[model samples]
Target chain A: MRLENVWLRYHRRGPWVLQGIDVRIGPGEVAIVLGRNGVGKSTLLQVAAGVLRPGRGRVTDRPARVGWVPERFPADQPFTVTRYLTGMARVAGLGRAAADEAVTSWTDRLGLAAFRSVRLPELSKGTAQKVGLAQALLRPPGLLVLDEPWEGLDAATRELVPELIAEVLAVDGSVLVSDHRGETVRLPAARRWLVADGSLSEETSSTDETIAVVEVAVPAARVAGTVARLRAEGHQVLRVRSDASTAVSQALPVEPPRSAGAARPAEPPLGMAGELTAEQPEAADDAVESAAGETR
Target chain B: MSALVRMRLAGFLRTGRALAPLLAGLITLGTLYGGGRAQPAEAYGVSAVVLFPVLAWQTKILLDVEPDVQRRLAQVTVGVARERSAGLLAAAVAALVTVAVALLFPWLVGGVSGPVDPGDRSIPVGLALGLWAHLLVVPAAVALGALASRASVGGAGYGVAVLALGGVGAVVFGLTGSVAPWLAPPIMAAARTTAGDAAALTLLGLSGWALAWSAAVVGGYLWRRRAQG
Candidate 1:
C-alpha cells in the first residue's frame, strides 16, 4: 500500500494536519510509526486504513481486506462483546459458523472469556481494547493499521500483541502501528517511520552493533527472576536496584531481541517507580508495570 | 443485496424503532375504519395524507440509527449503491407494513358499506387506489427524509415540513378544482374513486410524479454525500 503526496485537514478551512506526505509499506513488512501526540499519526494511519480520505493526492494499491483499529474504539454500541465480534466477522465476509468460531477463539485468546456476554459500555478500558484487537484480527486483513494498540491492555495481552503482529506478518500481511510507549522494541525487525511537523522520515535500523538503554522495575523479591528473564531475552542487565523505588537501568546490544528466549518475564513487585528518561513521568507507573508484569 | 437488506431489517427490528410508526399507523387505521362507513373515498384520502407524518418520522429514525462506520465498511465491501438500496428498502418495508395494516382495517370491520356518491366507484377499487397511492408515497417519504436529514433537519422538523406541504397542496387543490389531481397525491388518489373515464390516466400521472419525486430526493442525497466526501 502507498500514500502518494497525501494532504489532509479536518475541514476545508482548517489547517493541514498532513502536508505532502508520501509513504509506502510493502507486503509482509511491519512499519512502526513514532511521534508525539497530535502529530497526525492517527490521521495518517486513518488515511492509510481507508477510513479517511486525503484532500489531495491519493492512496494506491490498498488491499481489499484492510483492518483498522482506531485509537479509541466506539464502545457505546448496544451489542455485547461476542455479538459485536460476530457481527464484525460477518461484515468481514465470514459465514455464521466461522464467525462464531472466530469470536469464541479470539475471546478466549484475549482473556475475554468472562466478558463475552457483557455489553461493550460496561467493559473496562483494557477489556474493550482487547475486544478492539480481536475484531481487527478476526479476518486475515491484507493491510492492518493499528493506532495505540497497547494503550489500555493488560500486561499479558500487551505481550501477546507482538505475537499477533507476528502472525499477521507470517501471512505476508502488512502492519502499521502507532505507539507513544517504546513498545515497538517488542516488534520483530520493524522499520521506524518518524512523524514530525506533518512530514514522515524513514529511519532504517543500523546493522552495526550498538547499545540500547532500557529501564526495568520489579519488587525486590522478584529481582532475580526479572534479571534472569531480561538476560534470557538477550538484554545485558547493567544494574539492578532494590528499593521501594522501582528503577531498572540496563545496556543491551542494539540487535533485535531473540524471539526464541523471549519468555514471559516474572510479575513486578508492588509500588510505583520513578519516571524513566525516555517515558513520560505521569505514565511511569503504568509503563513500569506493563514492562515488568508479563508472566504467562 | 438480499443480505444487506436483511441486515438492515434485522437492525431496525432489533432496535424497536419501528414501533413508533406501527403505533401511529394503528391509531390512524382505527380512526379511518370508524369514519369510512359514511364516505370511503374521504377516509382513504385522509389515511393517505396521514402517511406523510408517519413515514417521515419513521424514515428519520432509520437514517439516524444507521451506523456510519458500518456504512463505510459496506462501501468497501458490497459497494455504496447496494448499501443505499438496502436502507431505502428497509424504510419502504416499514412504511408498507404501516399502510398495509391500515388498509386491512376496513376489511376487518365488515367492509365499506354505506350510501355511495353518484359519481363514486366500488369500494374495492377505492381501496386498491389507496394501496397504490401508499406504494408511491411511502418511498417518496423515505427519500425525502434522507434529503431532510442531510440538510440537518430533525425528525420533528421533517414531519412539520411534510404536513405543511400536504396542507398547502390540499388548499391549492381546493382552490383550483381541475388541477387538484396534478397538484397533490392524496387529491389524485381521492379523485380515482369518482373519475371513471380518466381513472387510468390519473393513476399513470400519479405514478409518474411519485417516481420523479423519489428519484430527485435520492439523487439529491447521493450528491450531498459525494460533495461532503
Candidate 2:
C-alpha cells in the first residue's frame, strides 16, 4: 500500500497535521511510526488504515481489509466482551458461525475468556486494550494499523504485541503502528518512519549495531536455567522481575552489539528463545519471571 | 451493510438513548387520540404532523449513538461510504418502527370510527394512506437528523438548533403555498391531503415533492461529510 503525496488537516483552515507525505509499505513488511505526542503520528496511521481521507492526494493500492486499533479503545459503550467482538467480527464480513468461532478463538488467545460476559465499561484499561486487539485480529486484515497499542497492556500482553505483529507479517500483511514508548525494542527489524513538521521521513538503516535492552520472559521454574543458559552462551544477564502473568520475552539485539575492546561473541541460539514464547502456564503455575538482560 | 445496520440499531437501543424521543412520541400519540374516535384519515394526518419532529429527533439520537472511535473502526472494516450509508439506513429503520407504533396506537386506543365526510374510502385504504404519508415523511426527517448529527454540527447545542429549525422550516415554508414550497418537505400538503378528500394526482404530487426535498437534504449532508473528510 502507498500514500501518494497525501496532505491532511482536521479543519480546512487549520494548520496541516500531515503534508506531502508519500510513503509505501509492501506485503510482509512492517513500518513503525516514531514521533512525539501531537506530532501527527496518529494521523499518518489513520490515513494508512483508510480511516481518514486525505484532503489532498490519496492512498493508492490500499488493501481491502484493514484492522485499525486506536490509541485508546472506546470501551465506554454498552457491550460485553463477547458481544462486542462478535459484532465486530460480523461487521468485518464474517459469517455467523465464523464470527462466533473467531470471537471465541481471539478471546481465548488474548486471555480474555474470563471476561467474556463482562461489560466493556467495567473493564480496566489494560483489559480493554486486550479487547481492542482481539477485535482487530478476528479476521486476518490485509493491513493492520495500531496506534499506541501497548499503552495500558500488562507485561505479558506487552510481550504478546510483537508476536501479534509477527503473525500478521507472517501472513504477508503490511503492518503500520505508532509507538511513542520504547515498546518497539522488540521489533528490531521494523523500518522506522519519523513524523515531524507534518512530514514523514524514512530511517533507511536496518543494520544499526547498538546495545539493545532485551526483555526475556520464561517460566518461573525455568528462569534460573534460562538465565544460566543465556549467560553461558556469552549473552549478558540483566535484572529479573517476576509477575503473575505467564510468558517470558527475549529482548536481544537484531544486530551484534558493538564493544571496542571485547571480542564479539557468537549470536545466541534462537531455538530456545522461540520456545520461550509459548505460554507454559503449568510450568509457571505461579508467576512468569522476566529477566530483561542485554548482551554486552 | 446489513451487519452495520444491525450493529448500529443494537448500539442505539442498548445505550438507552432511544428513551427520550420514544417518550416524546408516545406522549404525542396519546394526546392526538385521547379525545376519542375520529376519522382514520384526519387522525393519521395529525399523527404524521406531530410525528415528523419526533422521528427527526429519534434519527439524530440513533446517528449519534456510536462513539467516534468505533465509527472509525467501522469505516475501516466496511469502507467509509458503506459505514455512512448504514447509519442512514439504520435511522430510517428506527423511523419505520416509530411509524408502526403511531399507526397501531390509535387502533389500540379505540380512536377510529368511520370514513371521512365523503364516506367512500375503506378502512384499509385510510390505513394505507396513513402508512404512505408516514413513509413519505421518513426520508425527509432522516435527512434533517443527519444534518443535525454530531458529525455534521460538532456541538450538541448547534445540532439541536439545526434539527428544530429544519423540522419547523419544513412545515412553515410548506404552508406558504407559493414561494419555494419545494425547498422544504411537503409535510403540510400531506396532512391537508390526508385530512380531506384529495385526488390521487395531488397525493402523487405530494410524494414527488417530499422525495425531491429529501434527496436535496441528503445531498447537502453528503457534501458536508465529504468536505469534512
Candidate 3:
C-alpha cells in the first residue's frame, strides 16, 4: 500500500499532523514509520487502518484485512482476557466457535494463558499490552499496524514481538510500525520512514540527529544479540557503534518500556512534520565522523 | 443486541461502583414509601448500594485510559463505531435497570401485603420514577466524562456533574412542576397507580424522554467511533 500526497489536521490552530507524505509498502514488505513522539505515527496508522480519512492524499492498494493495536488495549469490560479476545475476534467477523479457538491459540502464543481468566483492568501493563497486540493477530490480516507496541513489555515478551510480526508476515500479512530501537528486529528487510515537521520522507542513512552523540562497541558476533538483548531490556539502543572493542563497563541492559502504566518519558519530539524514512537514514561519513568526534 | 445485553448485565454486577449509589437512592426512596423497612442498623451497605454508578464511571474513565500513549492511540481499535455505542448503551441500560429494580423493590414487595393501601402509592411511585429519570441521565454524563477523559478532566468534574444532575432533579420535583418528570414510568412501572390517569401520562412522557436520550447518546458514540482512524 502507498500513501501519496496525504495530509491530515485537527481543529483550527491544531498543527498539521501529516503533510505531503508519500510512501509505499509492497506486497509482503514491512515498513517501520519512525519519528519522535507527536509525529502522527498513530494518525498515519489510523488512516491506513481506515479509522481516519486523510485530508489531502490517498492511501492506496489496501487489502480487505487491516489489523490494528493502538497503544492502549481497548479492554474496559470485566470480561476475562479469553472472553475479551474472543469478543474482538467475533467483532472482526470470526464465528463463535472459530473465534473461541482463535482466542485460545493467540493467548497461548502471546503467553497470556495465566491471565486468561483475569479481567482487563486487573492485568498488569505488560499483560494488557499483550492483549492489545493479540486483538489484531487473532486472524491473519493483509496489513498490521502497531503503534509503539514495545512500550510496556518485559524483555522476554519484547523478544516475542518481532517474532509475532514475522509470524504475521509469514501468513502473508505486512506490518507497519513506528519504533526507535530498530536493531533487535529480525526483519532485516524493514523500510524506515522518518516523520518530522508534518512531512514524511524515506530515510536512507541520511536523516540528521542533532542530539548528543555517544559511542560504545562490543564483539561483532555478539553485536546483534547484544543489541537485541539491550533493547529487550528496554534501553534506547540508538545506531549501532560497530567500530571498536570497548570492553563492557558498568552496563545497563536495555529494558523493555516499563510495565503498562510506566511513567512516560518526559518530552517526546515534535510532531511528525519534517520527513519520513522508507529505509535507514544514511549517516554521512562527515556526520558519523563528527558524531564520533563530538564525544572527544 | 446480545453484546448490548451482555454489557448491560455487566453494568448490573459492577455493584461496588455506580450501582451501589443508585441502589442506595432506591433503598431510601423505598423506605420512604415502604412504610419503613429495608434499612440496616449501620449505613455502610446503604452507601455501597447507592453510589455504584458514580464509582464505576469515575474509575473507568479516570484510570482505564492507557496513560502512556493515551493521546496517540488509546481509542484506536478494531471494529466499527456502532459496535462500541451499542455495547455502551447496552451496558448502561442494563445497569440502570438493576438499580431501578433495587430502589423500587421495597414498595413492590410491600404492595403485596403491607399497611399502605395499594391505590395511595403515588409518593413511592414519584420518587422511584424520579430516581430512574436520574439514572437515565447518568450514562450521558458518564460518557461525557469518558470523552473528556482525553483532556484529563478530573473526578471533581464528574462529581460536579453528577451532583448537579441529582440536585436539579430534586429541585424540579420540589418545584410546582416536575423538573423533567421524564422518567415517571420506569420509576412508576410497579406503582399501585398501574391503573391511574395522571400516573400513566407521566410514565409515558418519562419513558419517551429516557429512551430518546439513550438513543441519542448511543448515536453520538457511534459517530465518534466511526470518525476515529
Highest lDDT: give the candidate number: 2
In the range B1-229, model 1's lDDT, one tens digit per residue, is 6555666666676678778777877777777676546345446555666676667667766765656655555454454566567677777877787778766777678546543668665777666666765676776677766655532343456645754565455436534355544554343443443333436776787677777767876787776555444
Off by over 4 Å in 1: A206-296, B28-42, B73-79, B105-119, B150-198
Top DockQ prediction, candidate number: 2
Candidate 3 positional error at B91, Å: 2.6
Q: What are the lDDT scores of the predictions, listed in order?
A: 0.68, 0.81, 0.54
Report how far off residue A241 is in candidate 3 (Å). Answer: 15
Lowest summed lDDT across 10 adjacent residues in model 1 chain B is found at B189-198
**Superposed Cα deviation of residue B112, candidate 2 (Å):** 2.4
- lDDT, candidate 2, A41-128, per-residue tens: 9999998988889999999999888888899999988899999999999999999999999999888888899999999999999999
Q: Compared with the true structure, what per-residue lDDT tens digits does model 1 show for residues A1-296?
A: 99999998876798988999998899989999887789999889888887667899899999888877777776756678988788777767789999999999999999999999998889999998888888888888888888899887766787788888889889989999998765666774888899989899998765532233334555666667666665465444544445433233221232234333332225553532221222122233333453422201
- The i-RMS of every model, in angstroms, reads 3.0, 0.9, 5.8
Clashes of 2: 8
TM-score of chain B of each: 0.77, 0.95, 0.45
Candidate 3's displacement at residue A155, Å, is 5.8
